[model samples]
Target chain A: MSATEEQVDHIKQAVERWNAGPVAKLLAKFPEQRAKFVTASDRQVERLYAPEAATIDRYAEKLGLPGEYPFTRGVQPTMYRGRFWTMRQYAGFATAEESNQRYRYLLEQGTTGLSVAFDLPTQIGYDSDDPMAAGEVGKVGVAIDSLADMETLLDGIPLDRISTSMTINATAAVLLAMYIAVGEKQGVPPEKLNGTIQNDILKEYIARGTYRFPPGPSLRLISDIFAYCTEKVPNFNTISISGYHIREAGSTAAQEIGFTLADAICYVDTALQAGLKVDDFAPRLAFFFAAHSDLFEEAAKFRAARRLYARIMKERFGAVNPKSLMLRFHTQTGGVTLTAQQPDNNVVRVTIQALAAVLGGTQSLHTNSKDEAMALPTEESVTVALRTQQLIAYESGVTNTVDPLAGSFYVEKLTDDLEVEAEGIIKLIDARGGMVAAIEQGFVQKQIEESAYRYGQSIDNGERVIVGVNKFTGDEPPTINLFEVPESTTQRQLDKLRGVRASRDVARVEAALAAVKQAAVGSENLMPPILAAVRAYATVGEICSTLAGVFGEFSESTN
Target chain B: MNAAVKPRILIGKPGLDGHDRGAKYVAQILRDAGFEVIYTGIRRSPEQIVDTAVQEDVAAIGLSLLSGAHLALFTRVLELLHDRGADDIVVFGGGTIPPKDIPRLKEMGVAEVFTPGTPARQIVAAIDDCLLHHSVM
Candidate 1:
């Protein structure tokens, strides 16, 4: 379906005429924003895209009907026409009790799902009372040390009624176990459980550094969860391989998809090697991506990721399940784009980013609060963020049709370019012996570092305009009151941890942790012992420390 | 004083926050600015930070945190440095610290607190001034 030379010459003549006529006149009168229009990834955006610019020579081959093979238009047959995306605002801070209150408030305010944010201690598998957890008990997100905290965190949330997404990695096994224990107490069976655990640890080694164990054990734990979830929690999304953190870590959109999919390949390869059928696990595999401010590029990124992943699942993995080929993803608005200087501007930024996610056909979305750049968003800010999504869903009328921007010349061209670029990067990663080896060799980190450095330089050099920071400078001090975690939160969490230790059957906890250690030592699935430990009220640190003793802690080699 | 003896700086993350882009950028910029910088990577405890500061024999310590635990973590680093009688090492802060906390941080013996959007050159200059003032004193 390649373009004919005659058609290419004809389109070229028309483009040259238009460029020399109206475009030149307009440029003489009013200059463009930049000399050369480029996306955040540094890809040049042509002034105009026509038939020749787009890569889809045969529409049926590149983008078939929606919900068909190579689902470039979208994953679902009726995206948003059937139902709006699940509005899941990521929120947590202070304590489980406090975070639970926030969750209830959001649910009442029309949030369709829950996305939990764990504090540093909870994320890295430390108890609230551990010396490492000292000032950070519940500052960033909710602190879930044991089943007690998990139960409190999800006290009134009906497990069967709503979907939950836990942004937990490294210690995803422990958190998922605690969640299951909580669900069991709520009278919900494992098969009825529905949620996603961000169990992708390769990104932890590459971008976000919350890893507890080495790569070998981390992949094993992930494989164990994949096996466990396929058998037990059939409806649950086992692993949300994430590019959100990678994007936040300053990777380009293509790198975000490339590195994330490369990690996905590693996970799927590991699962297959461990004897799990591709269809059994691939359907439940989900992705998490960041919706940055670039509206069209972000939308195209989503489309390209879907098309690329569909091809990978079908051609590479020999997946027969149609559901396995669909790249269902949850998107969170970019937090790094929120400016601290003019905090109010973040509302508009978040609105645009959320709209991009909607147009990109996200399965679920989390709009960041305006005040996040300053501090944890206040309730008012969070409500505004949620309302932004609602406005897009109901009032915007973009949801009336599926893949509204699918055939636009610019979008189609960008989507094709993104797919090719990302596929090229993935090929390089494959050549480097998969994502883990590449990460160990600092390939991924170096790419992200160079991109981050370039982005910063662009901002510094005035090539990239950050509205409030660079162009529209303002000196008004922020008047919004930030949500502050009280200093006593640490002490209160410590007291609660002490109380749990006193009340729990210490012998049972010890036995459960010992079993967890034994499981870590052997090739047995670590989920059962971890679940047993969580049920016995063993703390996160206790379980992780046992595994740490066996698997050993990862000391990153600094470049 | 030997001109060849570069002023070594220890860049430490003294809490559970894993956002190290700012710290890493600062480390690279400082290294380019002719300072030997040792980054303690992410999620280092305050004790570990202080120990690294001592072991590296750095003239200044730059602490970066985005997890909103700056007050407690910075206070612990300062206290530990005092405890170890290494208070001569200049301490500065970076990463998402609110403007209101900047004064308090400075009052608590932090030489400066570099917030978001701060250029690498500004940080390098601040470190240079701190080192120069420390040598004179």
Candidate 2:
């Protein structure tokens, strides 16, 4: 990319001459569609990017070779040529038996990994029969209240052969404990357990809002899992520090990177303070991002995120391991972008977002089904969603090479600009004394809320076009089959829960529960007692209630 | 309801799921439109919402839920409002609800149901209209 002074001068003069002659003449007649162009993130995009007047000097430092330091190109040198990104459809609903059927069907359809979406009751640590769980059992996802349910959930699936990712926080310890016990029953040892848990709690407080215990005990639980996983479940990923929810909450692409990494930095800082080595747990830490339809900005945002996180780990935390510096992530198409109107159009939206994720070099992907905005995607739409990824991988030529858009002048400029933008946000967060303090002071929530308001306003005033919503008109209400979670699911799950309670060793359960609370009160790693409790068939509600007594619940500090 | 005074309303989120962007945005819109708004943060129960509406003596109760439990949760709120002799409080709803259920929700005594893609001005106008025409008002 090096050029002599004469070459630069010639390029600049040629551009000026053409703009004055042809460009000026065309502008007087044809004209452009809009006065100014902007990305979905509101970044003002230039008509064209040129090296004649732009900064593209630091090639080696800023955009290194794939798999090298500051991995702005791609995390893997071979990229998809080595293997396509894991096609994981995050599916779970109804009873464990029903969800198990879905998982086996997906695996048969060639999904490489399994992602379990627990019901709201399970996510918030309520058993099926609990009063708070009324009318909500198995509504959004599969319900797992004890080791028995986890066993049924993973019934015929071989643990050692497949990687499972459970999207559970707040009660992540209890769920992971259940998962481990299930693995043991299948003759798969802890070391052979390959999977991830969305154990991130910061985003729960900031965006997702599934938090249970307060910040103190929440951080303590996360650190304990990190330490335990590094030792016993050596192949397991302990966390997926998520920005998917943050973006769903309407933050721009920049805030997605800024706030996610700030939360990550706090997690690392917390773990280190608990006496864990950075290299040990940092390698297993993962990220989750939403793939919005802003093609170039979405691609560049991923590149910028990789570079920013790498630099943060190496320079800020003094890390030496290369794996610790690499930013590995899972991408799910943005759920918020799917419009309930003209649900079929969502198929097209998911396709473009999926392409951006692939071009950005994601490690794994979950394409939101077209009908998700209305309800949980039906089986047919879920198949089409999975086929979207399959089409891009097998037909689209973009994944034939690594980081195909790496050298484009526009993408490179965006990469640099986005990195700078995110860093500025992180700096503001640090000025408020790190992420925990910022979240406690409601700074993080306020930033997201403002961005969300602006985004909503744009849609309302026709500044933003959501096809079938703001622009395209429909004369009559359209009817499409919506997936309904049968109310019988609650009754079925409650019966199973009652049976488990009637059959399990009551005395052993009490002992394990006491041990869990003792460990929670003291400074011991909580994984052991939690595993014991799960193995003894203690319900999720029982274990969580014990911890809640010690660590109290975290209520929103409303502004 | 008088032409000079905008009715007060309590916007509440009642469910396990915490998708609150819509709830917060509506609260902001109503507040800006000269209405007194109390936003019950995420994860409130129907009892809490009904109790708040009674205590605040608001003209309307706006509920939001994205967890697909809206039909049951909103029904519970309407039932509680009826039992408390506060059935005069206009109950309105919004979330990821489908059009097929809109009639059912309206028949359940929810004064209005706003789905996705609703304009801010329309929400403020609808609530104002709902309050101005109420029999108790």
Candidate 3:
């Protein structure tokens, strides 16, 4: 993608003619809108992007055809043309029954997949009745205490017909086990089940503070799930290495890409060290990312990530499987970019970011509602968010072709720059002894914090314009109904948890818990015992506590 | 606030949510504004936050909660402060709190509530103004 001598001369003559004529004339009359224009990541946008900007030696090698190695253009040869990206909305709050209703409603509304949001307690493996779960139960997402709760959560949903993505990390194994058990009850074998688990824990240590066990046992648990799922549940994505949380916590676009893949490398290395073949488990590995408002940067971020990851798997790990080289990912519109000042403006913002994700060729997508800046979105807002995706898919016509923005000079330059910049970041993290050691040494945190602080300073100094906040200010009170979880949700969940505890066989639960403890003590795959305990109706708190006894909990420096 | 005293403040995260960007930013700004700030990080209980405010002998406490559990968590923190005989410690807050809930939170002894997008200068000025009125001495 380089400029030939004739093409360079053509652009040079045309630019010189314009600059000397109309450009100078306009400059004397009126200046540009701002002194400088920058992208969301603060990269200066060139006034003119030409062929020289994209100087590729061989397009076939560097930017290969879709579905080939170095898939800079796209992962799928026929992306949304064959089938539109799966529209999965992340929704869950209150009790299992309530969340089930939401899921059914979403399915009825034509949502292709389900993404469950677990409450803080459920995420950290605390049952509803635990002391630490007092006020937080069901506040953020649905509270699933045991298999009973999971069963109710999936009440009438056809497991074989739909795919589900669970945003669970520290207790991903237990949650996945519960999901498998639910499939079993529905007469659908584990191999027939299709879904993904946010089984990534390194991102938890680096960005989100939701880790239960330390890194040693955490990676062991991850590899165990990897091996288990490969053998039993072939359709499920074993781990979704997430950059969404990292970007939400205020890392720049390149940092988000670098840190996420760094963590992925750590996981792959750990799985290899555990004596698993690269092709055996690498194909099931998926990624999750955030699509911010920067149009080309966000899109290029996805492209760069795919190319970089393809290289890593093929070159670094010697992965032979074609599926293993494809960096399949799900994307969500950036939550941090939503403004609380003019909440309705978020719809436009989300629309833009969602378009970026689609144009970048996401496998699955979630668009945030307008009201998320102030509260969990109401059903009305959720509908609007879903419709936004439908508009992009059907009405917008971007899905007519794969990688619609692939060959644009600006986009190709951005893709290359992002790849180089993110590779530099990865090299730095590798020098720090990989992601785990970097997170432990607080190097990654410090970098993110500094970026966040600078971003704040920019917004404060009006270097960046947040509509309805720094510019076009308004004080209008929000008339949109804020989605509120019932104050009694905690009590209702506690009651359900207590009833399950009372009705379940006490001795059976105890034996299952003891078996989990034994597995944790030894080098056994913790999945079987954990699944048994989950199926036996032992609470999440019980299983996590049993594991905690063997593997100590993680507490951050919290500086 | 006596300009000489450099009024101490504790910014506590009082919920299961670990979104600490706001809490951390506010703490950094307050510290830069010459207030001695103590940040008890994420997943802090009401009891832990109240005990830290009392133990640190801070003149004010700023609680940040984004999990929509602010109503329950803030009430409990205020109750604990009262129970610990530390009610004089001014407690302000911030997070994803709605405007309608601001009055309710203030009525619960929360001195002020800063929602998302509040500027650093405004937060520091408000804290300084509140500490001046609710003097530690």
Worst 10 residues of 1 chain A by lDDT: A51-60
lDDT of 2 by residue, B37-69 (tens): 999899988898888899988989899888888
Interface RMSD for candidates 1 onward, in order = 1.4, 1.1, 1.2
By DockQ thresholds, what CAPRI class is model 3? Answer: medium
lDDT for A495 in candidate 1 is: 84
Candidate 2 TM-score, true structure as reference: 0.97
DockQ-based CAPRI category assigned to the predicted complex of candidate 2: medium
For model 3, how does the per-residue alpha-carbon lDDT over A107-208 read when each residue is reduced to its tens digit? 989899999999999999888888888788898899999999999999999899899999999999999999999999999999999999999999887777
Clashing pairs in 3: B1-B132
Candidate 1: list runs displaced more than 4 Å.
Answer: A1-9, A20-33, A53-56, B1-6
In order, what DockQ does each candidate have? 0.63, 0.69, 0.69
Q: DockQ for model 1? A: 0.63
Clashes of 3: 1
Considering the true interface contacts (CA pairs under 8 Å between chains A and B), give the fraction that model 2 also has. Answer: 0.53
Question: What is candidate 1's lDDT per residue for A225-331, written digit by digit as tens?
Answer: 99999999999899999999999989999999999999999999999999999999999999999999999999999999999999999999999999999999999
**Could you give the CAPRI-style class of model 1?**
medium
Q: Which stretches of candidate 2 lie over 4 Å from their true place?
A: A1-21, A52-56, B1-4, B135-137
After best superposition, candidate 1 residue A464: deviation in angstroms?
1.1
CA-lDDT, candidates in order = 0.90, 0.91, 0.90
Per-residue lDDT over A84-112 for candidate 2, one digit per residue giving the tens place of the 0 to 100 score: 99999999999999999999999998899
**Candidate 2 — which pairs collide?**
none
